[model samples]
Target: MNITINRAAIESIILEVPDVAAAEAFYTAAFGLGDKLRFRASEEPTTGFRGFILSLVVSQPSTVDSLVGTAVEGGATILKPAKKSFWGYGGVVQAPDGAIWKIATSSKKETGPATRAIDDFVVLLGVDDVKATKQFYVDHGLTVAKSFGSKYVEFDTPASSIKLALYGRRAAAKDAGVSAEGSGSHRIVLGGSAGAFTDPDGFAWEPHLASQ
Candidate 1:
């Protein structure tokens, strides 16, 4: 089946950390993603299941290798080493603030015709209930591109450089080979002009006004 969706863009990712300054520095040097990362500090530590992933889809295998190398050099834990997968050359990393990231390239050279190259960004959130979260975003004006019966959901966010997606909590964790015991603050913020609101998992979505 084919699904067409229209929705707003994703401007930036807001992350809540125990120390904003440190996180800013770590991400800045690690993946050169500092430009897209915004930081806020919380007085108390975070707890519970912090569910989400910041994905970078590159177009070249070399770029993927370079990015993964930089992340390791910049103090990121290589949760999953980069390698050839059915999807392409990909790997996982846990950032200093405990955020998970999947870096990959879908170039035909790496993935053949199975997956096309994605020279873009995608923000995937791990949620306790995919159906409920998907409904919440739909009610708030976001559109869906594709979805699987309460297991996964993808939004039709093309106006911005980053796309949005949702996955089952345990499923997402299992994919990353990490425990789903995240607590405290989710430290995620969705940037858009859609107004301010919070999701069921306590993740914040704030409005973004384009510069005049």
Candidate 2:
């Protein structure tokens, strides 16, 4: 579907947690995501996976090792140890605040004609219904690049630094090897020019205004 809307690339993700300080420190020092990391404390303690995963795509295998090691040392649980895969070398870690992250580097040296830096970012949300959730974004003017039968979906968001994806709730949890059951608030805020709205799964989106 062809739909165009006035929107910036997804610039930042806000993760709500029970302990903002701990989450901030873990992301900043361990994942080297300090620049994009922001946190807010909940009125009460939070539990569960928070319904999303943050993916960091680096250019080198060594970078993946270093980042995963740092995350483990900083109190993250290694859900999947780093290893070589068909797509690349990657692993999973669950941070102190119950947020899961995937770190990886492509095996292919050259990506088509372009050779860019190693670091890239993506936000993957686990939704109750992938097709419906994807339709929700399409209704908001986002375009789709690839989609599968109610299992996975990815948006064509080249303008945004951080890409957005959706997956079936159980499928996502299975990929991360985490429990499918999650409770409490998701504690997430997606920043973009898409204006303000909440997805079917209750994730918030707001416009990101750049400073003059």
Worst 10 residues of 2 by lDDT: 108-117
lDDT of 1 at 41: 73
22-140 per-residue lDDT for model 1 (tens digits): 88777776566534567767655666447887888887676677777777877788888888888777888888777788888775364332323336778888898999999998888
| Residue 87 displacement (Å), model 1 | 1.9
Q: Which candidate comes out best when scored by TM-score?
A: 2
Give the CA lDDT, 0 to 100, for residue 52 in model 2.
87
The number of clashing residue pairs in each candidate reads 11, 1
lDDT of each: 0.74, 0.77
Residue 78 lDDT in candidate 1: 88
